[model samples]
Structure formats: C-alpha cells, structure tokens
Target: MYVVKSPLPDADLKTVADALQGALVDLVDLALVAKQVHWNVVGPRFRSVHLQLDEVVDSARTHSDTVAERASALGVSPDGRAATVAAGSGISSAPAGWVKDSDAVGALADALGAVITRMRQRIASTAEPDPVSQDIFIAVTADLEKHHWMFQAENA
Candidate 1:
C-alpha cells in the first residue's frame, strides 16, 4: 500500500481497497467474457446480440477502470493482470465453442447478475466505515443491474 492520508482510517482503507480490488478482478473478467460472447455468438439475431455484447464489454471495462483507480487512490495496488483476474474473479468461464444468441445472453446475464449481487454486499460492507466507497459500488450496481435487464430482455 502507498501513502494515503485520508480521513478514513488506514485499516478501513485497506479493507475497502481489498474489496474494490476483488470487484476490479471480476469486472475485468466479465469484460473479457463479454467479448468472447461477442465473438462467438451465432443465430438469426446474431448481429444484434453481437453488437449488444460490445456495450456490455464497454460497461465492464469502464467499471473495472473506475474500481481499480479507486483502489489505487486508496493506496492499494489493484492487480488486473489476466492471471489475477482468472484466479480471483467470481464469474465462471464462458463456453469455448460457438453459442446461440439466446445462450450468450443468458450466460452474460447470469455473470452480470452474480457481480451485481457481490457489489451490493461490498456496498453494504463499506456503508459505515467508508460511505464513499459504498457510493461507488452503488453506482456500479445500478449500471450492472441495467445491463442485466438488457441481457435478460434480449434473451426473452
């Protein structure tokens, strides 16, 4: 951890930073998995699903950057390397072979939903000790929930 003399205690910052790092790992993995879906999707609605996946990847990347920056600001060095993400992310591995548009939508929705659930927990964890971190997670949760809805709606 680097030097950061914030109002929040060092211990609290460390805890929050750890949580944010975990979030970063998951978001990075999600971004990669979304791109995998984008590349491998096939069906009558292939073009639409393929395009929609780009939006998901964009959102995941945005959140990953935000989360990593927050951790760094708090004096924690976030590990976003592919190995770190693969080892630490909560999201499961996507299928290797080509997938139907509906299947891709379902898989991405499930992955996003899992991360959103975990984000809510992270938000609550920081509610008392670090409200700012909580707010960041709240914002991320809203974005993820919106994406989850879109993916589910597309599948339907």
Candidate 2:
C-alpha cells in the first residue's frame, strides 16, 4: 500500500481496495476473453459479432482501467497482471479454440452476467463502509449490464 492519505479510514480503504482488486481481475480477464471471441467467432453473423466484440472489448478495457486506477488512488497496489487475472478471476474460462457466432455470443453474455452479479455484490458491500467505492461499482455495473444485454440480443 502507498502512503497517500484518503478521508476514508485505512481499514475501509483496504477493504474497498481488496474488493476493487478482485473486480479488476475479472475485468482484465473479461477484456481478454472478449477479444478472443472477437477474433475467433465464425458463421453468417461473423462480421457483426466480430464488430460487436470489439465494442465489448473496449468497454471491458475501460472498466478495468478505471477499477485499477481507483484502487491505486486509494494507496493500494492493484494486482492486474495477466497471470493474476488468469489465476484469480471469477469469470468462467472461455474455450481454447474457435467458437461459432451463437456460441461465442452466449459465452460472452454469460461471462458478462457473472461479472455483473459479482459486481453488484461488491457494490452493495460498500454501502456503509465506502459509498464512493460503491458508486464506482454501480457505474461499472451499469455499463456492463448494457453490454450483457447487447450480447444476449446477439443470441436472440
């Protein structure tokens, strides 16, 4: 942890930072998996799914950066290295090989849904100890829910 002093108590910051670090791991892994699906999706909807996946990737990367930066700002070192994400992320493992368009869409939606669920829990957990951190989680969750809806629409 760094030495910066935040109005939030050190204990509260530590709790919030730990929660954000977990969310960071999920966001990093989500970005990688979204790109993997983007690159490997095949079928009549290939181009459309591919393009949409790019948007998903962009959103995941953006959320990951924000979560990491927030954690850092609170004086904690966020563990967002690829190895850490691979090992610690709560999101499910994506398939190793190419996937069909529908399969990729379903997988991505499911993954995003998982992150949203965990994120909501993290958000609620901060209600008393750190409402600001809860606010960050709420913002990220809203964006992720939108993406999840889009991904689900791809399947419908």
Clashes of each: 0, 0
Task: State residue 122's C-alpha deviation in candidate 2, in Å.
Answer: 0.8
Per-residue lDDT of candidate 2, residues 4-36 (tens digit): 666788788767977899899999989999898
What TM-score fits each model? 0.95, 0.95
Residue-level lDDT tens digits of model 1 in 53-128: 9998999999888988887777678899988988998998997899998899999999998898889889988988
The true-structure Cα RMSD of candidate 2 reads 1.2
Clash list (residue pairs), candidate 2: none
**Which residue pairs in candidate 1 collide?**
none
TM-score of 1: 0.95
Model 1 CA lDDT for position 135: 88
> What lDDT does each candidate get?
0.88, 0.88
